[model samples]
Target: MHVGVLGAGIVGLATAWQLSRRGFQVSVVDRAEPGSGASGGNGAQLSYSYVQPLADPSIWKQLPKLLLSPSSPLKLRPQLDPLQWRWGLAFLAACNARTSRQTTAQLLTLAAESRAAFEAMLAALEPDCDFSATGKLVLYGSASSLEAAGRQLELQRAMGSEQRLVTPEECIAIEPALAAYRRQIAGAIHTPSECAADCLKLCVALEGALRARGVRFLLDCEVQGFDRHHGRDGRVRAVLTSAGDLEADAFVMALGTASHRLGRRLGAYLPVYPLKGYSITVDVDPASEGAPHVSVTDSARKVVFARIGSRLRVAGMAELVGHDASIPATRIETLAAATRAVFPQASRMAALHPWTGMRPATPTGVPIIGRLPRAPRNMLFNTGHGALGFTLAFGSAERVAAQLAS
Candidate 1:
């Protein structure tokens, strides 16, 4: 079978890799180079145990505060578009405890599956992506939030997670870099099995491996439309692209936010929207006492710090203002302030490199990974991963490949 995969991000590359493994002739098409999108320069934390969905019961109360606060990690720019209103309403509907808990459970299973798949790739591919099982520590500031998180640990434990709650002193003992903010932390959660890596490096390595295995890459190729003929087993005759019309036995839409635009041409409704996020990578001095070996999450500020090799990655903040991937000055400053406050001597602020990407998000925070009902049978979707795209890429590819094989 011949498969033409759309988008060259981590998800698309992983899917193409899996399809090639299944003995399919694959061609990947994308407008930019691999990993240039959200897959590049993410938070770098492979949060296997922390699989909580963004739409939780607490968000209902904190939404207004998050929007109004200048330094808040979340920003909401109200849009006049009907699609924006629809997504917002659906997001609001998913803010209840029932929906949040259900989504978390589903995400946990997928996250574990992804971790195992990633481990297998690490052993076989051995990509130089700074892969490590450095573990993770999440710091909570308020006593109330800490207590709530502690209560939630029981449920996570029941789901087979090995995360445990730790006191502020224990947190400092585990990660000495937190000594500066030890006085302000109320509590912490530690997951010893979590890992971290550079997502872009992994994508580049995978792309090279796939090329060596006879996969074709159509870089700078923009997909315009598809030539389809409706039937019992609907198939895409050819994919119209900026380069030329490419024909394949199967087509996969992994185009992140752009997937919605292409899906609309086929009369498919994809609830994927762009969630803009920012990150700054700074060189960590070897002699610095504030450099952390383990991945750290400041729960209060919603910022995460992960040390990938000699660099510290500081990332957070989500804006629901459509597909603008430009970095905001205030948000970048907020990240720098939070990093300096927590890990005082970790990085030189003047030398940090900043970046922004649009994470394809869904209302429930779970990715869509299946063939759309109204779309062609040969067409499959693997987008809307939101913030966890890097974390879930491998497992989602495995699922999509299984469906295609069946």
Candidate 2:
């Protein structure tokens, strides 16, 4: 079967990879090059074990700060658009313990599968993307929060996640870069099997591999609409694009935030919104001081730092203010400040490359990974991965390919 996968981000590329390997002809369509969206500048942490959803019970307490404080890690500006209000209401509805834990459980399963699939792909291709399995530390600032994390740790343990609560001293021993900021640390939860890699380089590698396997890429191609088949009920024969009507036996809507509008055209409702995020990549000098080899996430600030080769990727902040692509100066400064406070000497501000991308988020934080009810038989979904797009791409790709095959 011939399959046309929309969006050239990691998810679409991975889906194309899976389908091609399964003996299907594949084509990737995107307005830009692969990994040019959220995949290019994400958190870079392959958080396999710490797959917690954002709409946890804790968000209830921070609702005020989320609205009032501009400096808060999560920013929510009520938009005039109805979809924003709808998405916000659903997100608020999901802010409960039971629902949060349920979402976490599902995310953990998908993340585990993604890790396995990602590893298998890495072993086969051996792409030079600064891949590392040095593990990760999620630092809590208070003893109370540390205790709270312990309860969630137990739940994850039951789900087969190898996580452990570590003391501030032990955290220092595990990652010496934390020594400078030792006084602020209350405790940390460490996951030894977590990994990190350069997502953009990985996407480039996937594109190269897919090309070698006879897969086509329609870069700079805007998908306007679709040409429907009248014989089949709501079946799409081809996607009408700026390039032309590219016919295919099957179609996969892997366009992240853009999937919602496209789905509406095809009579599907995807509760996907753009949760904007920011990141700053800084050049590091290893000889000067303690450069963190292990990935670190500041739980209080919701900022993450990962060492991808000589550059440190510092990313954080979740803004729900519609599709405003402007990168504010303060947001960039916040990430730069986080880098200073976390690992002072890890990077110099001279070469800080600031970037912003809208994460295609769902209210529940769990990705929409299969064909929806209203979607055509040939239509499938692998979008709405939100911030975990890089982490869950391979596993979702595997599932979507399997769904098509069945």
Candidate 3:
């Protein structure tokens, strides 16, 4: 079978790799290079315990504050776009306790399944992506915050995540670099089985592996539309790309944020919106204090820290209602400030590379992974993962492949 996978982000790459491994002739098309989108510049967290949905009943109280505070983790740029208003309403609707609990359950299931698939892929490919299963520690700034997270931790634990609450002293013991904040650290949730990796490196390695496996890549090719031919059975024939028309027995839409546009063209109105995020990577001098080994997420600040080799990556913040990819100075400064507050010993923070990318977010946290109900039978979707793209890539890919095979 010939399969055309759209988008070259981690999700797209993983789907293509899995499909190719299943003996399908796969051709991946992307306007940009591999991992150039959200997959490249994320927090790089493979945290299976982070299954909580973004919408919480408590968030309603914080929304006014978030809207007022420019440095707040959640920011909504004032815009006249009707889609933005619709999305905001949908987000508010998902903030109910019942919806949040249901979403959390779905996310936890996908996270665990994805973690297993990722381990299997790593064992098979042996990609040098700085993969580490050293676990992740989520820290709260105040005892009240920790108390709140404790309930979430219990929910995660009940859902089969190896997560446990730890004291400030135990947190510092597990991650010695957090010693400076020991006094301020209220408590922590340590997920022992969670992992982290260099997402960019992994995508590059996977692309190379796919090439070696005879998977064709149509780089710099923009997909204009699909070449629809109504057969006697009323099935669409092939995808028409910018290069030319290519026949594929099956097609997968792993286009990340761009999936919405393609879905609309294919008569499927996906509720995926582009949520922008920022990150800064600083090189850690070996002569100075080494970078963090285990990834850390600051629940108070909503920032995540991952040490990729000798570089420390800090990523967080969500800006809705803007397609502008330009890096905002305020966002970068906020991330840098959070990093200094957490890991004060890390040196060379002045010189850092800042980047911004859009997360393909749905109103509900659960991504769309099933076959398009209205589209041709061969067309499948594996998009709208939002901030969890790196965390859920492999499992989503496996599911997409399974759907295609069925």
The prediction achieving the highest lDDT against the true structure is 2
**Residue-by-residue lDDT tens digits, candidate 2, 131-179:** 9999999999999999999999999999999989999999999999899
Task: Name the runs in model 3 displaced over 4 angstroms.
Answer: 231-234
Per-model TM-score versus the true fold: 0.98, 0.99, 0.96
| Clash pairs for candidate 2 | none
Global fold similarity of model 1 (TM-score): 0.98
Candidate 1 Cα misplacement greater than 4 A, ranges: 230-234
Error of 1 at 99 (Å): 0.7
* Cα RMSD (angstroms) for every candidate in the order listed: 1.1, 0.9, 1.5
Give the clashing residue pairs of candidate 3, or none.
Answer: none
| TM-score, structure 3 vs. true | 0.96
**Candidate order by decreasing lDDT:** 2, 1, 3
Candidate 3 residue-wise lDDT, 203-298, digit = tens: 999999999999999888888888666764334567778888768887888888878778877778788888999999888868866467888998
Return the lDDT, model 2, position 386.
Answer: 85
Q: Candidate 1's residue-wise lDDT over 6-115, tens digit each? A: 99999999899888888889999999999999989799999888877888888978888766876668878787877788888899899988898788888899998888
